[model samples]
Target: MKKEDLKKLHSSIEANFKLLEPFRKNRLEVIKEYVGSHFSDHGSEKQLPFNMIRLFVDIFTRRLVANNPSSLVTTKPLRLRPSAATLQLGLNHLIEEIDLQRDLETAVKDALFSVGMVKVGLNHSASVEIGGVLHDVGQPFMNAVELDNFVCDMSVSRWEDMTFIGDRYRVDLEFAQTKMFVGSEDAKKLTATGKAVQDNERHSTKELLEKRTGFDAEEYRPKVELWDLWLPLENKVITIAAGQLTDVVLNEIDWDGPELGPYHQLGMAEVPGSVMPLPPIASHRDLHELVNFTARKIQRQIHRQKEILGVASGGEGDIDRIMNSDDGDVIKLDHPDLVKDFKLGGVDSLNLATMVNFMELFKQMSGNLDSIGGLGPQSDTLGQDKMIADSSSVQVADMAARVTKFTARIVRDLAFYLFEDPLINLPLVKRVPGVEGVEIPVTLTAADREGDFLDYNFDIDPVSMSHKTPGGQLNKLMTVIQQVYAPLRPVFQSQGITLDTSQLIRSLAQYADLPELDGLFISDDGEALLDDQPVGSHERTLDPNTTRTNIRINRPGATNSDRANAFVQGLLGQGNDEQRAVAARATG
Candidate 1:
């Protein structure tokens, strides 16, 4: 890490921040309008600006994000190979081996920061008063569309516990403010090199640094909390300064940006389409204004609905007399001929129609009508509803997939760092078809760290992706089941073939996301079914909870054929006696 290198990253910060001027300005207006309180009242005395429309879209944006990860990044084990066996027994072992889910979740969050951190250094230790008060949990989280907001004063989410350097002193992720828009140039430079840049005037970092050196303080600045002032200097030296008020470079290293890029900011996905870095929020400003005007007009009409009278001259008492609420009230006027009357505003269906037209136009312009669907069950066909619900999920998943590439790359490079350590110890796992799993104690060699030793990949979870509740997983499951397994079913059964239920469950889990799928021969408490015996004396019920409980049965004695038969029986039981008789005869 050279001073020139740190300076290069700083230069990138400045150039990128300057370039983001338009996006920064535009995002403020969008979020402002979305929050429904930041608009002008158009100089009118009647200030009735309805924010219903913007609020709807605001919630919609978050819903899009909340809908993301489950579909956008499948929880199914992110494998080292695409076609690897789930039954390999060692695959799940590999997931535990790599600590995939926990690390990857945080990594995804960091990747998000990296995108913003590249242009505007991320505020790792930053926290507002409201802290984790999320905009909308219903919407997607860490969405790329909200990237502009993250760069500005908008407090979006960040990855927690993401440190790239070695453990003892390295703090990967911290809460800090983005110095690109709000802090000093030196602070911004400090931030570019993966430091937690913050408003140092208020923290204990200054005292800690000074106290460490046991020097009387005068010439120093407060750095971020829990962080030593690690600086990269021009002579290709990176140092961890340990003094309070002076630079005492403790440890320095010679390193390139490439080695650190993956470790530091491995994942950050940028919002797509030009104007580059301009979010979808940029397009909705005009539409918000339009809706604002429409609301104002509606409010004006309400005010005008009251009868207004004018005269050549009238006192306050006279006006009050005219405004009397009595059913049979009369008022005296000196100038009868001078009296002028104005009634309520006329019915303008055209304005209402115009507002609807504008709304449609806005949706079309923004291309966000994917969330709008028919209210009645008959309004949209099943396929049409599924298409509408899954469209955004699909698009969002694809966008995140791009970010996954960087994450994979960073995780790959981390192998060299982790494996090179003498203390490193990981089980060497190998898959053998039709064989028992074995773990061999293995030590890393220099050769294993030199090349692309791992080939990990990602796939989106389409099954867990749909926007609707209850039916999303089922919908996707049914679809893939119909396409992939339905045709194979008759053929397999006719040829006396069978499918591995666990393997099928794993494959379908990518699309179905059924919690019940994990219940295969396992109790609700997660104990093996074979290990459990029913305690009939515990809580006996004279009446069954169902017409029959066969398909629902998962006690110790139930077998695959019994489950299948129970499902068929339950279907027949749902019908009348005649149907049941026919079913019984057919089965016999």
Candidate 2:
């Protein structure tokens, strides 16, 4: 790349960012609202009574990222099924390989508070230790990018619709030399760039840091600012240091990753005719202010004490004794009637009511129910409380759907990386079917994913993503079975596809998050076996003519009597010796 071409590209990016100044201003204001007046230059006397924005944002993030969403990968062709499992296992490994949950929570918080967009990309190491040997490693990553750091045209409404995207960030001078611009002539210019941008506080990153920590963090660690420009049409990515070496190209390479460029922008709310999604904090900023104002007024009233001493004629100094009197102190006034108790008005009942109403209104507006925030039950009756919870779940479901879609896209991108990146060869542990707690190591290499990765469909299991106890998950699964599977069973049978009861049980256990119940029954010689044993273990044979053993089942939500019966059956030699001994000890 020539110096003139680099300068031209730099000017183009600057002009593009200038066009987005209005949106940037709005995002900054929203961030300020979230920070509130708690850290303003004003003295401690004018501190905010309460920060409703922060509270609501916290609630929103907690509700959205309550659980790490799981991905479901499957292919249409039977040949690709194994590949799909490989992809799924790779994703599961990736979740733990990186702190994916923390990154997701950070992204959710970023979307809720700062900007409505998040950047998801692939992070890889040039070399890593694999089996005590140096090898390369790669995996998908997500980050909460500042609005100013993310550069794209605001006219496009979707990331897929955009022609180009760019990410602007700063890296340490040493990192720039070793990792980013390595073996390139541009690496020598990093120090110049760092020195030039050391005192530059024009970027939002510096400004936001100052607003948050009340210090210029830029001086703490000198770094070189760089912009990675991606042109989807040309399948190219260009990197350059932004400040002093803006006309010097650091690195340029052809992009072979996902076609949509590396960044995927996600938001909770969508705006028409624009790419900038509205932050959740931006929607109710005024209501937040109103709530704080009302609470501040109430606090001021509480702090104000007005008590006067009413007296008759010539009693100004006579009440000094009363003024200085202590508990159990005997103070005599010149006249007994001189020191009459006269107390003025204090806090108004109306102000208290207004404050309560504002707080409740804020909760209602943001869909942060009392139960959602763990503030205790809101209604008198249990049924009414459930009804309120159900109503709030509608909004929660909508938000969850949006998050689910966002997570699915990320999974899809990860799948592509797993297919294309040669550095990713993950050894995953796979559970064996019909065997409880049995796992085997499986290796997935680039050779396994040989075809187009886009052929396989990737999605997030919403039930898995939701924060639910085992019992709640069981109830949800029961509802799905009763409402969906039961009715469709006949249709499936009509198509000569009989339900596999064992597989069904396995799926139920998986969805209920009860891994202990996985592979509860293993079949052998045309007979279903329990605990890898013959039917005789339960005092019954495989003979159809013989009477079956009477087994008591203790399902979820079972009555105490049912549980007791199951326990007694176990004690009466219905289970293995180990189980019987445990049951005997429990009974004792």
Candidate 3:
């Protein structure tokens, strides 16, 4: 507006272009050329006002391009000229020898029609080629006052007698006039700033059109034919998702050296020792970050599936169940049962905990990235590394496989216990206390038992298991157990005791083909199968002697049943022969 202000604006524009330079090349130069050619008119003074208008258009166009370059095509500079009405009036005033109002009007109308065509064509071309809809749309408003005056004059009663204006010109004039007329109403509507009034107007317009035509206005509404320049919605979504994931991964892995420390401060600290050493750091933070990122993505996918299933089932679902499950309940140290039930061990639990932690870290990182405006090349490079770590399959097959294996292990260790005792079936049985007509019966077979135990155990040592069974036999075994025991495991695990191999074998013996007890042993050692079936087994045994007899105990004891029963009275009488014999035996 003023010389100083204009200079400031120009400088601001240059700075903005510099800031955006990394995204593209010479954008600022192109913008400057456009503004100079259209507004300054190759150093001419005659079209200064018109040049100013052009400069405004160029600035807006460049901004739109910077925000999203795919929307508009770059083109040769436009030639600015006088509007049709201006040109027609000048021609008539300069060249006429006689009164030629009627002819002059016709010429004006034709010129206006030609100008409209040129403007519309340019607008459409830019939208289709370079994405200039906003720019061209803004242009028509520059001559709004003149166009409205011309249309109003044409619409006057006496003007009806004049038919010299060609059909094409007449149609163009009518369209422009109608649009301008409606725009005036729209301006008033916008001023209200009330949502109710806006909504009423929208509905009123539709109703009015429907009443006049006996058809819905929406039925005939024009479809927006978006030009090729605009990116598809799907593509944008994918790009955003990828960038977000990449940024999250980078932050989670803490790829930037000493930046991982508290407050990102780096320096030597005083120590009592003779020498002070730097904190140990990972050599390849990027590599570790990539692994963590891929793992988190996989974890998210699994949870997402669980969430979807929960929604589909019309219940609070598994996620809610897990959250509300007794596992969350605080237990006293005196509550041995609760303590035993909640204990989670081995690699499966550790891996799951790690995955959950990583996912949360990634989420926090994503938030930070969003706050900073978005991911850039640095983030994408990190994402590429993560992709490689998880395998280069865009389909996420590798991730899916990892999830499947992990899920199988969970099912085996937790679910196999449903087969131990009929009481364990309570966890698997689904029933609404008052509404239920029949309770679902869940049963687990021996093969299911063995498969689950093996799976759970193997998953605890995946690297070793993978080496032992490179053919994926262990994975297959785990999968089968998962499938068969899935319906029953949740029920049993809910009751506290883990479903081990003994429980599975016992459950299978009830309803399905029972394999030989000897076959269940992977080793030929003479250890009793039930007692020596590892610590995770349902039953344990003890060796009997001639002086003492073995008795089955409710819970496994330190020495099984081989020791004389201390709870028994008179068994250790001081002088009785039998008591003396027992006392000597106990002392021995």
Of the candidates shown, which would achieve the greatest lDDT relative to the real structure?
Answer: 2
Q: Tell me the TM-score of each prediction against the true structure.
A: 0.45, 0.73, 0.14
The lowest-lDDT stretch of 10 consecutive residues in candidate 3 is: 235-244
What's the lDDT for candidate 1?
0.37
Tens digits of per-residue lDDT for model 2, 1-588 = 677866776777777777776766666666566665555542123344667777877777777776776879888888889778878888877766655566677677777764545555565566532111232345566555666676775556766676667877766666677675668866875763433332332336335434433232446665666777787776888877775677677877888877666676667777787777777777677777786777778777777857776888778767777778888998767788665777666666666555556666777787745556655554445565678778877867777778778777776776677677775567888888866679988888877774587688888787765566666666677877679866686575577555455555655677666667644655555454323442124332234455658876532233222233345455344656544444344211
Candidate 1 TM-score, C-alpha based: 0.45
CA lDDT scores, all candidates in order: 0.37, 0.65, 0.26
Q: Over the stretch 84-121, how does candidate 1's per-residue lDDT look in tens digits?
A: 22212222333344344433443333232222221101
Residue 210 alpha-carbon offset, candidate 3, angstroms:
28
Error of 1 at 311 (Å): 15
1 versus 3: better TM-score goes to: 1
- Sorting all predicted structures by lDDT, with the top scorer first, yields 2, 1, 3
List all candidate RMSDs to the true structure: 17.0, 13.6, 39.0
10 residues in a row with least lDDT, candidate 2: 128-137
Q: List the residue pairs that clash in candidate 2.
A: none
lDDT digits (tens) for residues 1-588 of candidate 3: 234633443344234323323212222222232233344323221222222223223222221112100111111223211121222222222212112222222222222111110111112112121111232221111111111111111221332232111100111222222332243322221111111222221222222222233322433331111101101211110000110111111101111111111110111121233121121111222222443455555455555542212122333333454445584675333323222122222223334434444333432332221111111211224343344333322222332243234323322222222222222212133344545367754333232232212222212222221212223344455666778655565565677545466545544543344546535644346554444454345432223332656774342122101122221213323245543344244221
**Model 1: CA > 4 A from native:** 1-22, 38-253, 256-276, 307-343, 368-380, 383-468, 477-489, 495-588
Q: Order the candidates by TM-score, highest first — what do you get?
A: 2, 1, 3
